[model samples]
Target: MATSGLLNTDILSDEIFDESQARAPAKRCDRHSHKPIDMYCQTHDKVGCSTCMADDHRSCQNTFYIPEFIRNNIYQSVSRKIQTELNKITKTLAEQASKFKQDKQRLLERKAELLADIRRFRQEINDQLDKLEKNSVNEIEDKVKCLESKIDDGLKQIEALEARVTTASNKIAFPNPYQPDVFVNMKMADDAANVANKYMKDTKIKSTVEELDFKHDRTILTQLEQIIALGSLTEDPTKMASSLFRIRGDKSYCVKVKSDTEDCYISSACCLEDGPIILADHNNKKLKQIRGYNYTVTDYYDLPERPWQVCSISKTDVALTLPLQNEVHFISGEEKMKRTNKIKTDFECYGLAYTNNNLYISDASTSVYVYTLSGTKLQHFSETQSGQKLFSNIHSIAVSKDGTRIYVADFYNGLIVLDNNGQVITTSNGKQFCGAKCCYITKAGSVLVSTYGSSVLQFTPDGELIGEVIKADSEGRSESLSVCCNQQMSRMFVCSIDDNIGVYGI
Candidate 1:
C-alpha cells in the first residue's frame, strides 16, 4: 500500500520528534552575569545555557556553559588560591605551638627555683632544732650533777650533828662516879682545938702576971688567931681529892708536856711533817700512863686526878691544865718537875692554842680567854650577842700565823672569827655541825674544819663551801686536827677518837 519513500520519511519524523521529557534541565550560567537563574542539574553548579549565553547573559562577566567551561579549564587558578590559604593556616598553627612550648619551659624553670628555696629553708630550720635539743640536754645534765653534790654534802652534815649531840647529851645526863664526898675529922679537930687553947691560956697568964701593961701586941694576937684557925682545919676527902682534867699527846712528838702532870696518857703516833699534834682527851678521872707500853716513874709533882689538856711551850717547858681545878701548871721536861709558872683559874677550860707570844684558852663558860705565855691576862671575848655571840661551849681555838685573827670553834655555832682586839669579825653561819672541835686557816686562805662525824669541810675565805677533804665513818668521831707549817713539807694531820692520826698532803 504505501511507497518506500513515504515509509522512510515517517521513521525520520518519529526520531526527530522524540519527546523533550527525557532531557535534563539546562544549568543557568552565572560566570560573569549580573543576574542569572538556577538550573536543575545534578552534577554541575548553576551555569548559563547556550540560549542564555546568546541572550542577556552574553554580556555578563561570569556566564558560561557548564560542559564548555569544563572542557576548556581545569580550575587551576582557584586551586592555586586554596593552596595558598592552607599554607598560611598551617604556619599560624605552628607559631602558636612554639609559643605554648616556651611558656611551659618557663613554668618548669620557675618551679625548680621555688623548690630549691623551700629545701634550703627547711634544712636551716632542722639545724636550729637539732642544736637547741642538744643544748637543752647538756644543761639538764649539769644541773643534775650540781644538785647531787649538794645532797651528799647535806647528808654528811646531818650525821656529824647527830654524833656531837649524842656525846653532849650523855655528858650532861650522867653523874660523875669519881667525885668524893667530904667529911670532917671530928677527933682531929678536937685535939687541935685543945692544943690551941692551952697555948693561948698560957700566954694570957704570963702577960697578966707580968703586969707589963696591956699594950695590944698585934703580932702576938695575930699568931694566936692563926693557931686557932689551923686547929679547926679538918681533913675532908672532898677537899683532898684532886680536881683535874687530862689531855695527852703522842710520845716522840716534839712537845712532851704542854704543862706538867704527875701521870700522863702517852701514845706513840706517826704523821707527816707539819701534821697537827695528836692528843688524848680524858673526861673521867682515870689515872693516865706517862709512857706508852712502859710504867714510868709514878712520883711527878702533886699529880692531878687527870690532866685535861697539855701544851708544849718549848722543848723543855710545857703547860698542862687541870681543867676541873681551873688551874694551869708549867713543868720542865728534863727535871720531870712542875715549874713555878702555875696559875689558878675560876672557869672550866676546854681547849688550848698558842700564837707567837700568847696562848688562847677556850672554856665551858663560852668564853675565849687570851693570855700571855707567862700567865699574864690579856683579853677575853665571849660569843653571846650579835656583837658578842656567846657559844654554848668552846671546843677549840686557832690563831692565824700572823696573829691578826683568831678562830673559835663553838659547839653550837659553826666558827667564830675574832680580831686581835677581841671583836667578832665574822661568823660561818648555816654550816651544819661545823662545831666539832677545831678550825684552821690554811696558807691559801681556805678554812678547814674537823667536825665530829662528818668529813672535813673546806671553805673559801669568803665563807663559801668549796669542797670536802675527807669523810668520816658512821661511828668515827673526829676530836682534833693540826696542820704542819714546815714549808719543806706540805701536810695536814687529823686526830680522831679512834686513837688514830691521819696525814694528808696539800
Candidate 2:
C-alpha cells in the first residue's frame, strides 16, 4: 500500500492490468486519503471513498456504494430538490428585476415631465418679453409718426409762403405797370410773413431733434442672473401620522458634554438625517454631536463666539447663528466637525432655520430676515402686511416640512405662524406659551415649543395649543430652553440652561 492509501500500479505487469484502465483518471475523495470516491453516506448526506467512510462517517447509520445509490434513483431525487429551491430563488430575482425596470421607466417619465415644465416656463418668459418689446416699439413708432406729421404740415406752409414772397419781390423789382396786381402781391407777401412768424413762434420745429433711446429694464437681467435654478426636486411626500399623542417624557440623559471653563448650556438642538443630535453649547461657545441610546458626546467643534441657535442643513452639515459676530457659520463632517463656511448678516442673527436653500434668521429683536444660503436677502418680516409688529423678541424659528409655513417662538407674542411669504397666518398667545424659547416642527406638521418657564408646550401646525408635553418641577427651577425630535418623531430631546439633556420617548 502507498502512503496515499492507493495500491501502487507501477510494479503490476502489463498482462495483469488493462493498458487503458491504468492510463485512465478517476475522481478521488477530497479528504486525507486520495482514493477513488466509491461510497455514499445517506445518514450524513455526503459522498466519500471507503477509507473516509470508515474513518469519518463511522457513526453514520445509513451508508451505501455510490454506484448502487445512483442506480436506485437517489441522485435524481436530490437533483429535483436542489432544482426546486433554485427555481424559487430565480423567480424572486426575476420579480425584483421587473420592479427595477418599472422604476426606471417611471423615472424616465418624470424626467420628461420636468423638462417639459422648464420649457413651458421659458416659453412664457419669452412671450412676456415679446409683448413688452411690441409695446415699446409701438410707442416709439407712434411718437415718430406724430413728429413726421407736424413737420409735413410746417413744410407745406413754408412752400406756400415762399411762393407769395417770390411774387411780391418780382413785382417790386420788375416795376409792374398794373398797380392793383403789385398791391395784391405785396398784401399776400405781408400776410405770408405774418403767418410764418406765428407758426415759428407756436411750433417747436427747432427743438424737434428728439433722441429716442431704449433704457432696458436692467432689473430683469439682474433677477435672472440671480436665479440658481428653476426649482428644486423633492422626494415624493409620504403620509406621516402625528406623533404628538404618544409623546411622554419617560427618559432623560445627561448628554455628558462640557467645556474646560463653563458648563454646557444647550441653547439649541437639531437632529441630523441619520440620527445624530447636534447641540449648541452657548456658554461653552461650542457645537457638539451626541449619538446612541446612552447619549454620549461623540464629537464637538469650538466656535469663536457664542452660538445662539443651530439648524441642520444636511446630514453632515449644520448652520449656527453667532449673534455677537453677526454671522451664520456652517460646520460639516461625520466623525469630526469642521468649520466650512459662514454667511455675514446685516443684523444680529439669533433664531435660525433652514429650508429649500433658504435661511430664516431672527434679529432677536422684532424682525425675521430670510436669505439664500449664499447670503442674498430674500424677504424681511418685521411687521405684518397690515403693518402690525410681528414679533417682540424672537428666540427661535422652525419651518414646516413642506417649506410652506414658518413658526416663530416669540417671548412676548407666544407662537406666531406665518406663510412662506412672511404674511401672518395665525397667532397663539397664552400663559403656557408666553415665554416661548424654541420651536420645532415635526414631519407631520405638529409644533413643539419650549418656554422660559419649565414647560414644553405642544401645538398643532396651525398654532392651536394641544397641551404641555413637559412641565416644570415642584420648585419651578428648571426651564426648557430648546426642543427637538428625531426624523420619525420617536424620540424627543429637550435641554434647559444646564449641562444635561432630557430624552423623551414618543
Candidate 3:
C-alpha cells in the first residue's frame, strides 16, 4: 500500500493507481533465510559475500548489505506515495480550470450579442428619425411652393389690369395724330400738321365731330386687394426665405432605477424607472454614485451587524428591524438621521409595514405588534387557540392598500389573514406553495416569493404556485427580493443577493 503526502494535493502517481502483476513470495538464499535480498541484485538488494556478486548474479553490477538497503530505500517509499496523490490533485485542478474557461467564453458571447442588439436598435431609431425629418421638410417645401405659385398668378392678373388702365388713360389724354382736333388747340399744332389740316379743311367744310371730356378714370381693383390681404405675397420675398415653420410641442421623457440590498451577501440587482424608494445600505459604509448618473452614495446609518428585514415608506422615510437588536430604527433622507421613532421590543422583529396612520410589525416571538406612526405602542396580538391548537412565530407582515386587512406569513401556519382589529379571517398551510426568505404581490395580483434555492417562485394570489422567475445556479444563490412599479424608461428593475440586477420591460 502507498502512503499519501502533502504534495498529493498537486498530483498523483500513475504506478500507485494501476497494478498489473500479482505479488509473489520473496526469494532468498537457503542459508541466512531471515535476511532480505533485492529481487534483481541491485544496489538496495542484499549480497552475502563477494562470491555471490561475481558468480550467479554476475550480470547485476550493484549490490548492498541487507541493513544498508533498508536505510537507503525507506525514503523511496515516501517519494512514491507523494507522487501518487499529486497526480490525482493535478487532474482535479485541470477539470476545474477547463470549466472556468468555458464559463468565460460563454459570458463573452452573451456580451457580444447584447452589444449587437443595442447597436441594431439604435440604428433603427436613428434611421426613422432621419426619415421623419426629411419627409417633414419636403412636405413643408411643397406647401410653400404651391402657395407661391398661386401668389404669382394673382400678381400676373393685377399687372394685366394695370396695363388696361394705362391704355385707357392714354387714349383720353392724347388722340391719334391723324384724327382732327378742331377749335381750341389750333395754335399748338405743328407746321406739317397745319399744312395737312389746310388741305383737309377745304375738302370737308362741314364739321360734325364732337370731342369727349377727359374725366378721372376709376377701375375695379378687387383682385389687387384680395392678393394683398391674403398675405400670399411678402413685402420683400428675400427676407421671408430664412424663416422656419412652427410645429406642436414635444412630450416629457423619464428614467427609472430599481435596487435591492442584503447586509450579509449581495447577489443580484435590477433597475426600473420609478418603482420604489431604494436607499443605500449605508450601515456598512457610505453609498456613492457617479456624478451625472442616476445613482449616488449618501450618508450612513448606525446599526448592529444584522438587520434582516427593511422597508422604505417614502422618499424620506425608511424602517429597519433587527433580530439581535430587537428594535426598529427609522431613518430619513440623505442625512440618514434617526427620526423620533425608535420602538424597542423584547422579541425579535422580522418585518415592518406602515399604513397611513399606523405601523405593523412581525416579531416572530409569539405575536405581532401594532404601533402609532410616532412610536406609541397601540397593541400586541398573540396567537389565539383554534380547535385546541395554538399558533406562534408570526414570520412576515403586509398591509392592504386601504388598511382594511393585514396579511401575515407564518412559519408553520403558512399564511394567516387578519382583519384590522386582529381577528383571524383565514389561515392557509403554504408548505409546498411559499418559501422561507421573502415574498410580495405583483400589480397583477400574483405573488412572488424567494426560496432556499437560487430562483424566485411565482404564484397566483389564490396560492397556486406558478413558474419560477429565475432558476437555481451552481455559481450563486439568492436570499433577498425587491420589485419596481414605476420605471424611468419603460423598464423595471429587480434586485437580489445574487450579485446581479435584472431589467425587464412591461
Candidate 4:
C-alpha cells in the first residue's frame, strides 16, 4: 500500500514537472545561485529556491501560494482580461491609422484643385499649400508615433506580466498535491504570480489617439493667384460687391463691327456713367456704341485716322486718340456720338483716359501726356527725378479719384505708379503687371489691369495686388486689349483684341 501511494505521488510529480518545464524552463534561484527557484519575494519581485527564500526573501511582505494562483487565475480569467485590453488598443490604433490615410488623400486632391496655371504666382501658392499639407501630416504622424510608443510600452509590460503569471500558474497548477516538492515550490510561484497580477492590475492602457485636424486659410483659395504672384493676398473681408450688367444675347458678347465686315478689331472699350457701350475699332477706323437694354447698334462714327483708344470724358462725351495723325478727337452726344473737335499734339497719341475732368493720354514716345478739358497740356513727367525715363513703352494711364496718384501700364517697365508729385511708387516693374496692356481705376478704389499673361489684375488704391481672371477659358484667346469699369465700378468690361468682350463683377 505504501509503495503504491509513493508511485502515484511520483507520477503526479512527473506530470507537474513536465507542465512547469513547458511554461518556463527551470530558472536559477537568486540567492542559491545554481539551484532551481522554489520561492517568491513579492516585495522585490524576485523568484528563488529554498536557500534564496531564507537568505533573501524571509523578510518579504505580500507572499503568495503559487498553487492557489494557478488554480484560480492562470489559463483563465486574468490572462483573458489582459488580452482584451490589448485588442482594444489595437482597434483604436487602427482607427487612427485610417484617419491618417484619409487626411493625406484629401490634401493631395485639394492640391490638384489649387494648381490651375503653374505660373510664378500660381506656383508659389501651390508650394505654400504643399508645405502646409506636409507640416500638417507630420504633426499628425508625430502624435501617432507618441501614442504608438505609449501603446508599445504598455503592451511590453503587459506581455511581461502575462508571461510571469503564466509560468508561475503552470508550475503550481500541474504539481502533485501530496508531494513535499510541491509544497516547497508552491511558496515561490504563488508570490511570483501575485506580483505579476499586481503589475497587470496597475498597468493602465489608453486606447485613443491624440487630436488631429487641419485649419486652412479661407481667403487663400479665393486669391491664390495673387498670393502666388505677390507672395501675399490681403483684402477687406467685409467688402461685398456685385454687378448690375444685363446680358445681351450671351453672357460675354461681341460688339457689332460693320456690315458683314469680318474685319472687326477693337482696341479699347469703355462704359459711360450713363451705361452706353463705346468700342474703338482701329481696324475699321470707327467708334461704335451699343444702346442700353436692347443693345442695338447706334452708329459707327468715322475718324480722321484710326481711333486707337477711347475713354469716357463724361456721361455724354468721350475722347479718342489717332496714333498716325498725332491727334486727339473729342466726341460728344449721348445717343449718336460724332467727332465734336480735334486737338493736335506734337507726339503721336495712342492711349486716352479721363479722370477728374482731366484727359490723360499715352503717346508713342512712352510719355504720359495729361491735359485739361480744353486740350491744354498740363505738367507731364518724361523721367523720374533720378533721371530714369518715366516709361520705355506706355500702353494706358489711370488717375486716382482724388487726383493724388497716377497709374500707367508701361509695356516696358510693368505698371508705373506715381504720386501726385510724379514720384515713383512701389508698382513700377511689379511682376503683377509685367504684361499689362490697359488699366483703369474703379469707383471702389481699385486699379484693374489687363495683361498679355491672359489675365486681369486688381490692386487696391494702396497698391495691394489681386489677380481676378475673367475665366480660365479666357487664356490663350485674343490678347486682352483694354479693361474698363462702369459708373459704380462694380461691373467691369474686359475687351479683347477681337470683338468679344467679358463682363465681370468685382
Candidate 5:
C-alpha cells in the first residue's frame, strides 16, 4: 500500500495530466522498509535490506549490492537518457502553446468576417428603403407640379379675357359714336367672355392636394431595432461596467439614519428616481421616508398592523403588506395621507413590489402572487414548485425594467431569477450566497442586494457576481438588513435592522 501527501499528489496529478512530464530517477527505496537500498534482491524482484532476506526471501538467489552492480559505467547513460526526455518535453510544451495562440487568432479573424457581413447586409437593406422613400416623395412633388400648372393656365386665360372686356367697355362709355368698330369690338368681347366661361367650367375641379398626403406606421421604427446583437468581442470585460456604479475596497457611509435615537428595525426599503426612500418598519408599525440628500425623517405614516414590506405605487402613493392580517394596503396622498383600499389574499403576503400598475407579491405557499390594482389575481409563479434546496425561503422580489425578468433573493438559496410569466430563468442552489435579504434591480440591469450579517453586493442581471457594493464598517457595528437603489441608479439606500440607514452613490 502507498500513502501520498498533498504536495506528492499534486505532482503526481500534474505528471498524469501532461504525459510528457519527466521526473528525476528515484535515489532511495519507495517503501523505506530499510534505511537505504543497499542490496538488490533478484529473486524477490525488489531492493531490500538484511531483515527482508532473513524473514521472507532468505532462500532467494542472485542478489548483489547496489554500488557493485552500478560500478560498470551506468550513471552517465542514465543522465543522458533523462536529459533527452527533458528536451522532448520542453519542445512539446512550446509547440502546444503556439498552437493554442494560432487557434485563438483564427477564431478572431472569423469573428471579424462575421461582423463585416452584418454591416454589409444592413447597408443593403438601408439602401433599398432609401430608394423607396425617395420615389414616394418624388411622386408627391410631381403631382403638386401638375396641379399648379393647370391652375396657372386658368389664371392667365381669365386675365386676358378681363383685359379685352375692359377695352370694349371703355369704347362704349367714352362715346366713340363716329367709330363703327365699337359694336364689332363689343361683339368680340362678348364672344371672348363666353369662351372664358367654358374654360372656367373645365378647370373648376377641386385643387385640394390633401389627398396626396399619406399616413405612416410608427411601429416600423420599433421593428427596425437590432434583429440580433453581436456576441463576439475582443474588448476587455472590465469595459462592460457601468459609469454610475462601482465596487471599491474601501467602504464608508454617507449618512447614518436614526443613529442617535432608538434602533429602528427596517424590514423593507424602496425609492424613486433620486427621491426619498420609503421604509417599512415592522417593529414600529409604520412606513417611514428618509431624505436622500440629507438623511433625515421626511415623512411617515402609522399602519394598521405590522407592515412586512412597502413599495411605491406612484409619486405620492405606496402599497404596504400586512402578513399578520393576510392582506395588503394601498395608501395615496402627498401632504395628507389616507388608506384608500385593502387587498385580502388567500395566504400571508410577505413582500410586495409594483411594476406598470401590476403588483408582484410573495407569500407562504411557495409561489408569488400577481395582482392588478383592482385586486384581481392574474397569475402565480413557476411550474416547478418551491422545495427544499433551491427555491426555499424567498425573502424579497423585484421585476426587470422591461418587465421581462424577475429577481427573488432567497434566504438560503442565493438569488433565483425568473421570467415575467413565472418561469425559472436561473437558480443559485450551489453558489456562494450569504443570508440574502432585500433585493433590487437597477435600470442599467445591475442587481444590488444586502445579506444578513454581511455586506451589500452587486451582481450582473444574469447572476454573475460583480463585487461587494458596500462593506460593514470598521467599528463592527451592525449588519445590512435592507437595500434599495433608485430607478436612475444615481443614489442608493441601505438599511440595517439595528436602527441605522445609510445612503450611497451609484
Candidate 6:
C-alpha cells in the first residue's frame, strides 16, 4: 500500500507540472535582437531583456528584474484594476446618456409650449374677426330697420290722405247730401289733396329706393394674405455667468468703395459673422460687400433705389431699407450677393434692424414699425403710452441682443431707449448725442452712436456715455453715418458720407 501511494503522488506532481508548462509561454522582446524579456524599465514603462536595457535604458534610474518589479509593485490584481476602470467609464457613460435624455425632454417641452402659444394667438385673431363680423352684421341690420321705418311712416301718411279723399268722395256722392256736409267734405278733400301734393314733392326730394351694401376693408384682407405666421420662433437667450468687458476702438482702416460716376455716399453698413462687411452706397445705389482683412470689394449688387439703412439678419443674410421705394430688400450669400426677397412697407422705410426673427424699421418721420420676417406687421410705435411722441426724425434703430430693449437714434431727440413694447425707458439727450444719425449695439451690449458729423460716440448699455471712439480725420473728411460691429466685437465698420468706408478695430 505504501509503494502505490508514492507512485500516485509522483503521477500527480508530473500532471501539475505539465499543466503549468501548457498554460504559460516564454516571452521574448520583439526588437531586432529578439531576446528573452526579463527586465522592467520603470522610466519608459517598458519590458526588455538585459541587452535591451543596456542599449536603450542605460540612463533609466528605475530598472529591475521583471520578477522583482512585479513582486514589489503589483499589490493588486491587474484584472481587478481593469475591471475598476471599466466600471468607472460605464458609470460616466450612463450619466452622459441621462443628461442627453433631459435635454431632449426640455426641447420637447419647449416645442409644445410654442405650439400652444401659436394656437392661442390664432384663436385670439379668430375671436376678433368674429366680433368684427357681428358688428358689421348689426350695422347692416340697423340701417335696414331704419330705412323700413321711414318707408312705413310715409306709407301711413299716404294711407291717411287716401282715406280722407275717399271719405269726402263718398259724402259728396250721397243721394240726400246736405249743403253744409257737402261743403265740409269739399274742404276736407281740398286739404287732403294739398297734403298729398306736398307729400309727393317731399318724396321727390327723398330717396325712394335704398340699397344696402357691405364694403369690406381691403386692408384687412391684404394684411391677412401677407401674414406668413402668427409669430416668430427663436431660441431663448442663454445667461452667461461671466461679465462682459468694455471694448475700445484701437485702429481705423479707410477703404474706398466707390466704383461709379458719383462719389459713394455710404449711408449704412453691416458686419457679418466672420464674413465680408456690406456697405449701402446711397449715391451709387448699390450694396457693396468688402473684405475686412484686405479691404477689397468682393461683390456688389445694384439696387433700384438708394438703400438708407442695412442690418445683418444672419451669417449670410442681410436686409436693407430703400426709403424711396418704401421697401425692405433682403439679400443673401456667402461669397456673392443676390436679392432674395423684399417687404413693402406702408411708410417709407429708413432705419432698419433685425432681432429675434423680427424686423424693426423707422420711417424717418415719427413712427417705428415692427414686422415679422415675412412682412406681417406686428406692431407700430409712433407715440408713447402717455401720448408723447417717441421720436423726432428717427433715423437708425437697433434692438438688444436678448430682444428686450430697442434703441433709436433720433436726429433731434438724441438716443432714445425703449422696452420691446415701445414704452420709453430712458432718453439721453446729452451734448455728445447731437445729431444722432445711426446707432449700433455691440455683442457686449454697448451702444455706439454716429452723430451727423465725423464723431462716433460709444455709450454703455444703460445709455451712459463711454467716450468718443472715432473722430474727424486731419482733413475733416470723415463724416460717419452708419456704424456696426462684428459678432465678436473685435472690429467695427463705419459708413461715411464720403466715398470710403472706415474699418476700426475694437
Best by lDDT: 2
Give the least accurate 10-residue stretch of model 5, judged by summed lDDT.
Answer: 6-15
Runs off by more than 4 Å, candidate 2: 1-243, 247-249, 256-258, 473-477, 487-489
Candidate 1 vs candidate 3: the lDDT winner is: 1
Off by over 4 Å in 5: 1-244, 247-262, 382-390, 471-477, 487-489
lDDT per residue for candidate 4 within 91-117, as digits (tens), equals: 999999999999999979866755543
Q: Pick the candidate with the highest TM-score.
A: 2
TM-score of every candidate: 0.38, 0.52, 0.39, 0.50, 0.49, 0.50
Candidate 3, residue 8: Cα displacement in angstroms equals 83
Ranking 1 against 4 by lDDT, winner: 4
- Model 5, 38-115: lDDT tens digits are 665544446565454555567766565655544422344444555777899999999999999999999899889987
**Candidate 4 TM-score over all chains jointly:** 0.50
Tens-place lDDT per residue, model 1, 1-506, is 12322112122221222233334334334554444433212222233445554564444455544343333334444445557778998999999999999999998998797778767877886797688667867776776677667657656755665554555445545545544311123333444455555644654522222342324436544333322121121234232222111112222222223343223332111111112232333432232223212212222344454555455556445565667778766655443345657776668776666668687877764778888866777888774446645666666666775777777666677777777777677777565655555665554545666675546666554444565566555333444443222112334445444333444543
- Listed per model in order, the count of residue pairs whose N, CA or C atoms clash below 3 Å is 32, 0, 37, 6, 1, 0
Error of 4 at 153 (Å): 99
**Candidate 6 clash pair list:** none
In the predicted model 5, the residue pairs found to clash are 264-499
Error of 5 at 335 (Å): 1.9
Give the better candidate number (1 or 3) by TM-score.
3
Select the stronger candidate by lDDT from 3 and 5.
5
lDDT of 1: 0.51
Better of 1 and 6 by TM-score: 6
Where is model 3 poorest over a 10-residue stretch in terms of lDDT? 244-253
For candidate 3, the TM-score is: 0.39
Task: For residues 357-387, write the lDDT of model 3, one tens digit per residue.
Answer: 7788877646667878667788776755453
